[model samples]
Target: MHELTTVTDSAAAQLQQVRDLVALLDDAQYVRRPPGASSVAGHVRHCVDHYAALLAGAERGTVDYDRRERGGALETDRTLALARLDVVRSRVRALAPGVLDRPVEVSGIVDARGTVARSRSTVGRELLFVAHHAVHHLALMMPVVRTLGVSVPADLGYAPATMAFLRQRDGGTPA
Candidate 1:
C-alpha cells in the first residue's frame, strides 16, 4: 500500500507542478504554438489524458491509450485543465489498497506497422508507466516553456533515475 501510494503521489505531484506552471501563463501563452512546437496546453493535455485513461482502466481491468479525449476545453483553457488536474489528483488519492496489484490488460498500437498489441499488466505497473509518460511529455514541453519565457522548476520533468543520478553527481544524497 505504501508503494502504491508513493507511485500515485508522485504522479499527483507532477500534475501539481503542471498546474502551478499553468497558473503562471496567460490564456494566449497557454495555447500559444511556437513555430513548429506544440502548445503548453497540448503537452499538458496529453499527460492528463494518459492519467485519465489509466484511472479509468483501474475500474475496468483494461486500458486503451488510443482512445483518448482530445482537443477539448482542457487542451485550450488553463482553468479547465487545472480543474481536471484536481479531479485526477482526487481519484489517484482515493485509490484502493488492493487496486494496484490487480491484473490489468493494456491495449494499444505498438508500431508503425499498424499492429495492435495487448499485454497483461497491473495497476501499479500502469501507474509507473504514466508517471514516466508524464515526465517524457513534460521534458518535451521544456523548450516550449522556455520559448514562452515561463520559468519552470529545475527538476520539473526529470525522471526518478535521472534525478538520482544528478544528485549523486552533485555529491548529494540520492533521492
Candidate 2:
C-alpha cells in the first residue's frame, strides 16, 4: 500500500494479489467448482485475460476486451496460471511512467446481443480498469475459496480505492 502511487504500480499490486490468492490453492482447488459458482480457475483466467489484453493493447494502440483466451491452460493449469501472473506483474511493473498517458483505442461487446462499443482511453486508464476488474472477480472467488476450505487473507482482492479509503478510515488497511 505504501508504494502504489502510479497506475502501473497499482496494476502490479493487483497481479500480486492474484498471486497471493493462487498460492493458497492446489491444482485441484484452483479448478474445483463450488456448486452453482464458477471455478476459481475460471475467474482467475478471466481476470488474467483482461490484463493480457491491456498489455497487448498498449503495444498495438487498440484494446479489444472481448479477445480473450477462453478455455486456455490458464483456466486449468496452476503452473501456467502462476507463470502468466508473474509475467503480467513484471510487465506492469516495467511500464514506463510516460506510457500511462499515451492515447489508445478500446472496444468491447456491451450486451448479450453482440453489440460492440468503442471508446478512447489511455494505457494508464485501462490498466487501472483491468486491475479493478480483477478485484471484482476476486471478490466473487473469495466465497468459492472459502467453500473449498481455503483460508483467504484479509486484504486479498480488495479494490485499490477501497483500500485507500480503508487506510484513511482506520489509519491502515482493514484487518
Candidate 3:
C-alpha cells in the first residue's frame, strides 16, 4: 500500500477506537473520578474538542484553539457527548487525508500571564499529541475509576492495546 493510504488507514482506525471507547462509557462512569481530577468522560470530551479544532486548523493552516475552554461541563448528557464525539470524528476523518502533506497550526497562551504562542505541525502530529494527552488523563483517572467501584476496560493504555500487542508480537514492546 502507498504511504498515504497507510497513514489514512491508521488514522481512521485510531479515530474509530476513540469512538468505540467513548460509546462504552456510561454517564455515571463518564463523569465519575477519584477524590480529585476530572471525570473520564470529561477528559475524553476535552481531547475530542482539541482534536476537532486541530483537524480544522490543519485544513485551514491556522492555529485556532483556546485552552481557556479546556475543562467544563460537556453537554450534561451522554447523548450530547456522543453526538459531539461523532462530530469530532467527522472532522478528524475529513482532515486525515490532507494532513500528510500539510501541517496544521496550533496556538495557545504560554501562561496565565497572557503570552500567546503559535506552532505548526502536521495533523497527524496534533492527533498524536491529543491521543497522548487523553492517555495521560485516562491513566490518572484509572485509579479514580477503581475508587468509584467501576469496572475499567481490560485494555486501556497510553499506547493502545492493539499497538502494544503488535509491538510485542513483533518481538519487542513499543518504546
Q: Pick the candidate with the highest lDDT.
A: 2
Q: What is candidate 1's lDDT per residue for 40-125, written digit by digit as tens?
A: 89988988889989988989999998889888888878888888888987887787758989899999999999799999999988
Q: Model 1 residue 82 lDDT?
A: 80
* Model 2 CA deviation exceeding 4 Å by range: 1-5, 172-175
* Local distance difference test values of all predictions, in order: 0.84, 0.87, 0.63
Q: For candidate 1, what's the RMSD?
A: 2.4
Error of 2 at 121 (Å): 0.6
Stretches of candidate 1 exceeding 4 Å from the true structure: 112-114, 171-175
Using all chains and alpha carbons, the TM-scores for the candidates as numbered come to: 0.91, 0.92, 0.73
Against the true structure, candidate 1 has what lDDT?
A: 0.84
Alpha-carbon error at 79 in model 1, in Å?
0.5
